[model samples]
Every structure is written in C-alpha cells, then in structure tokens.
Target: MADKLDHLLSDYFRGKLDVAIQLRQMELTYRHGTPDENIGGGRKQNDYNNVVESRMIHEQNDPELKRLRYQKSVIKMMFDCLIKSHQDVLIDKYGNKKGWVTIGMDNHIDERTARE
Candidate 1:
C-alpha cells in the first residue's frame, strides 16, 4: 500500500509539472516557506537582522547566504510551461487535465493581453 501510494503521488506531481506547478510551488514558498528549505518564502524580516549581524560580526559567510539566492530561471521556466498549458483550457471549471510568476506573478500571465 505504501509503495502504491508513493507511486500515485509521484505520478500526480509529475503530471502537474507539465505547466505552472512550479509557479504554484514558488508562490507557496513565498507565503508559508517550508521548514525543510526556507527558500519557499525567501528571507523573513528577522532573518535580515540575524544574518546581517552575523556577517558583520563574524566577517564570514553564513549558510543562509547560499539559500538567499532565488531560483529565478527555474521559477520562470515553470511559469512558462504553465502559461503554455493555460492556452488549452477549454473551460473554467475544467482546465488542465492534470496540471496546475514574478515580482511574483503567474508567469505574468494576462488574459486581457489575449494570450492565456
């Protein structure tokens, strides 16, 4: 049962990856930021003080430093796939069969622009 569950979960996630699932993950990270990797939310206000103080006092880099960088390209590519998929949405309630941004937009998708 466990193996079967894992397989289903993996398959579901892979299917979502065809479009903007990456974008969704990025947004989730920005809002709640998983404990496993704070990259989900970027840096918080408290982190700034601590990291900056440590850097100045220690005069050395910090682990938080490496995690500070945003995976911009990866995020954008994910958004692009999502945008492309949206183009095929035949209905509102029923969109992508099994799938799922910037300053943090949805690939900066603009329906008014008439492009998905």
Candidate 2:
C-alpha cells in the first residue's frame, strides 16, 4: 500500500505540468471551438445538444484527465492533514525527488527516520 501510494504521489508530481497544460488546452478548445478536422461526422440527433452539456460531457468522459485530477486531489488532502515536518519530508522526497540520505540530512533526521 505504501509503495502504491508512493507511486501515485510520484505520478501526481510528474503529471502536474501535464495536467495544467491539458486543462489550458481544453479551456482554449472550448472557448474557440474544436477545429473542423477534429470534429466527427455523425447523423445522430439528440435534444440535449447544447454547448454547456457538450462541455460537461467532454470533461466527464476524459478518463485520463479525471484520474489525474483525482490523484492531485488525494495528494492535496493527504498533505493538508500532515504536520509541517512530515509535509516537508514528503515534499523533499517526492516533490523535489531527493534521495533518502539527502532528505534526512536536510531535515536533520537520520535516514531511517526520514524513510519512516
């Protein structure tokens, strides 16, 4: 479980920039409308066809973006509950991608304690 959480945190850290870029692109696409080549040709007609509904559907259907958002939120919630020292340790280890020895030294704790 710890290893899984660590992996998730690592992915969250690495995907932050990607998430931001994707969100910006989504916003721009919504604002300016999708390009002609990107639009699909379908003959199905639905009464629920509206810009707001389309945007909501587009966002909701994007699984990768949704997963990234969830991972980001989970990390944020975990961070919010931790003490300052623990938060710093997490940031040093995951956010800064520092080694255990370096993190321990920076925090004035031994390597084992830092790992813990």
Candidate 3:
C-alpha cells in the first residue's frame, strides 16, 4: 500500500522544478520590466508604464513565489525524514528527472529495483 505522505511528497517533488521556474520568470519580469515604448500619448503613456511596472515589481496579487518557497521547504523536510535509499531514489527520479534506468545505472542496481 502506498503511504499518502509518500504520494504527496512525490507530487510536490515533481512540481518543485516548475514552481522554481515560475518564480524565476516572475523575478525576470520584475527585473526586465514591462516595455511600453510605443505609447502614443504623453503623460498617460508614462503613467500607464509606471503603473504596470510597479504592479509587476510589487506582485501584490500573486503569492506564488512565497507559496513555492514554503512547498520547497516542506519537501526538503520530508526528504530529510526519509531513509537514505528512498531519499536517493526520489532525489534521482524527481530532482534530476532521471529515469529508472539511469538511476539504476548510477546506483549499480537493476532498473526494476530502482523502479521499486
């Protein structure tokens, strides 16, 4: 039988990379800023650009980065609680997105064993 925590942790691990990527993209948007150079109006154009840029930098509505960080910390705590073998397998499978075959080869074990 599969433990519920194991399943949740596995899912969390798989999503970790994607969450990190999203956070990075958000940060990049903040750093690079929203370009609105071709605004035909004068003060309105500048105001609009400033508003957009401020919103992006503030990220008031989106707590995704913070949530991802919390999730990552939870995943890390779960990993620390797991046994060495389980930790190795999960880290290889999820962290590096490695296949069972690669994990097996790396660990000097059969692919089937790695899969288990």
Q: Which candidate achieves the best lDDT against the true structure? A: 2
Candidate 3 residue runs with Cα over 4 Å from true position: 1-62
RMSD of 1: 16.4
Which residue segments of model 2 deviate by more than 4 Å?
A: 1-4, 14-49
TM-score of each: 0.18, 0.65, 0.44
Cα error, residue 21 of model 2, in Å, equals 7.5
Identify the runs in model 1 with alpha carbons over 4 angstroms from their true place: 1-51, 55-60, 63-73, 77-82, 86-116
Provide C-alpha RMSD values for all models, in order.
Answer: 16.4, 5.7, 7.2
The sequence of per-residue lDDT tens digits that candidate 1 reaches over residues 36-68 is: 556666756554536445434432233332222
Itemize residue pairs with steric clashes in candidate 3.
none
Query: Order of candidates by TM-score, top first?
Result: 2, 3, 1
Error (Å) of candidate 2 at residue 83 is 0.4
> Could you tell me the TM-score of candidate 2?
0.65
The local distance difference test score of model 2 is 0.76
Sort all candidates by lDDT, best to worst.
2, 3, 1
